[model samples]
Target: MTNPLFYAKILLFGEYGIIEDSQGLTLPYSFYKGALKFSSLDSEFEKKSNTHLTKYADYLLDLELPKGFELDVQKFQYEISEGLFFDSNIPQGYGVGSSGALVAAIFERYSITKYNPENISKDQLKNLKKVFGLMESYFHGRSSGIDPLICYMNLPILIENKESVDKVAIPESEEGKGAIFLIDSGMTGETGPMVQIFFEKMKTEGFRKTLKEEFIRYNNACIEAFLKKDMNPFFRNLKKLSNWAYEHFRPMIPESIFNVWKKGLDSNAYYLKLCGSGGGGYILGFTKDYEKAEKMLDGFHKEVIYRF
Candidate 1:
């Protein structure tokens, strides 16, 4: 039997800003996905995955299981023994929610109370986030559960603030000149250290003021404009947000791409932002013209995610 597939995700906006209650928008990126399967041949990768899964299962077993949450530990162990492994292509540390897919797969297969994304109540969603967050914290040191949430739901989620999140509709992809794309930074990003840097910066009053006054305002405007399909306002706010990130979140941006990022703003050909934690990983890009942006960004890899 073919197990379910969980797709990767991109947090289009709101990297560290979300921690300060800035609005965020996340969507599943089906181009990359993962699934759980039995490795009949038990190859090295499969064996490694099985071993990791066993350890994870053991960790879960030690937890004081919460009410209404049940994991069939024995069954999970049996599956691991049978060489069950996560077969995935999502790149770890690229900020595309690799572990998130694994967490979603585990929750779906093992959780007795299967919570369907469709029509799930806000309370149920909140509970699910807590569960996934705790489970994923093993990998990230800390987690907001947003990554796994997007993978689990496979839907676009609009984060109103730190407190409220709900599935939201986005403008339909259309054939047009403007596009959203991902650019490979040619390096992987670690979430924990990058997060630590953000927290350290938050210690300053200046950083706090910039986060609340400038970052959140533009972020909220970008989300609202994007959802409304108001491209002019979306790009306008996006440019400001991009500028803020460039000015303030320099540590998060890959050192190699600083010139490329600034070139976009200078030329107005494209704008770049963090796809995830942004120490390295993939850098997200937006452009009014893909062809022109490609010309401007020669010698780099680019993948078009959505066109408008």
Candidate 2:
């Protein structure tokens, strides 16, 4: 059977903050995606993927499956034996939900009581998040499940803190000067350690206060502003959030991009923030003028994600 494509995701806001109940916004990036397929035993890639799928299936079976979710383990094992594999182009460890996409694809095809994307309910969404979260914990030590949820739905997810998650609509693209882009840090980041650093930092009262008063406030406001198409306030709050991240989330930002990150803020031409857990991988960038931002970041690799 042919399976549907699962796309990558960008957590535009709320990298570590979402762990502390801060709001987050995630969008599907169709540029890179994955799907499930069965291939002949001749392909080495297919053999390796089949092996990994077997291990992953074993892990999922060990979990306390959520209600309304069922996996046909026998069939899955048979398929893997037949060289079932995930054929994907999404880069792993780049904070773009690569593993999440894989998990979503597996569940979409294997889960018997599947949640209908067209008519998903609050209960179904919550249950699906729980299932995906548990399934993904095998990769990241812990997950909010927002990544796979976005991949599964292929829709923008607005996280209004830990309790409330809803599929949100973003404003239509504008042929304007402002834009959102991704800057490659040229290194893969491990989410576990990056998250560990944030957790350790949270033990400090000052860090906790800064996160609550500054980070969460600006992060949430940025989402609201962008949704309303309030460009001025969006960039204004984004700048503040970017500055706060530079000052507080320094460890999470890779050493190589520190200068470039600061340069953007100093120039007032653009702003940069952690794309996911930071450390290394893709750093998110915002610019009021893409042409100018490109000139400023000429040497580095940058991909425009959304145009304002």
Candidate 3:
């Protein structure tokens, strides 16, 4: 049987704000993807993945899943013994759902009660998020489960709140010069520590207030404007969101990309924001003029994911 492929994801908005029940928008990023495969474990990559899967299988065996949701852990263990490894090109720690894809692959293959992504309802989507949260927590210590859910459904999801999430339709890409892109930060980011920092920041009344009143407002507005194809409002809100991140998310921003983030705001050519937890990995960028933004961001690597 051919292994099913799982794609990477990008959380366009609502990074830390989601924990506080703010709205979020996430979409599949197909440029990088992964799949489950059996290998001889000869190559170092295969051997390492096999070892990790062994440990992950052990973890799954002890996990207490929600009622009616269970993994065939015995089969998973047997497959690990048979040199089952995740064959993926998604970059780990890039905030693009590498581990999430792996988790989705495991669930798709081993779940006792299968839920077809195409036929799932809103309630089922919520339950899937809860299950994915429990499963993906092994990697991040705490998880919102958005990453794995996106990978599993392979669809754009809009989070209305903690208990309300549904599939969403986005504007189709166009041949225009504007674009949504990713910029390589040239370093890997650890989600756990960055999340820790965000939690610590939450302790401050001022920061929490700003996040709710400013950050989330801009985030949700951007999502709404983008969906309606209101470019003016979208870019306006995006600029605000990008500026807010620069001012408040300083700790999460990697030092190397600090200047580049500021350069965008200053030049008005493009706006940049966190692709995930920041501190490294890929930084998301939006530009009304991709060519100008490309020229401004000359030294850094960039890939346009959506054009308008």
Q: Compare the candidates by lDDT and give the number of the best one.
A: 3
Candidate 2: the clashing residue pairs are: 252-279
Alpha-carbon local distance difference test for all models: 0.89, 0.89, 0.94
The clash numbers for all candidates, in the given order, read 0, 1, 0
Q: Give the distance in Å from residue 27's predicted Cα in candidate 1 to where it truly belongs.
A: 0.5
User: For model 2, how does the per-residue alpha-carbon lDDT over 76-185 read when each residue is reduced to its tens digit?
Assistant: 88888888899998888789998999989988888877667869976677778878888899999898888999999999988887867888999987788888999988
Shift of residue 297 alpha carbon in model 3, Å:
0.2
Comparing 2 with 3 on TM-score, the higher-scoring candidate is 3
Where model 1 places Cα greater than 4 Å from the true spot, the runs are none
Error (Å) of candidate 1 at residue 92 is 0.7
> How well is each residue in 70-173 modelled by candidate 1, as lDDT tens digits?
77778888988887999999999899999999999988888888777898877777777778888888889888888999999999988777767788999999
Alpha-carbon runs more than 4 Å astray in model 3: none
lDDT of 3 by residue, 1-308 (tens): 48999999999988998999889999999999999999899999999999999999989999999876799999999988988999999999999999999999999999999888999999999999999999999999999889999999999999999888999999999999899999999999999999999999999999999999999999999999998999999999999999999999998898878998899999889999999999899999999999999998898999999999
Which candidate has the highest TM-score of all? 3
Which parts of model 2 are misplaced by more than 4 Å?
A: none
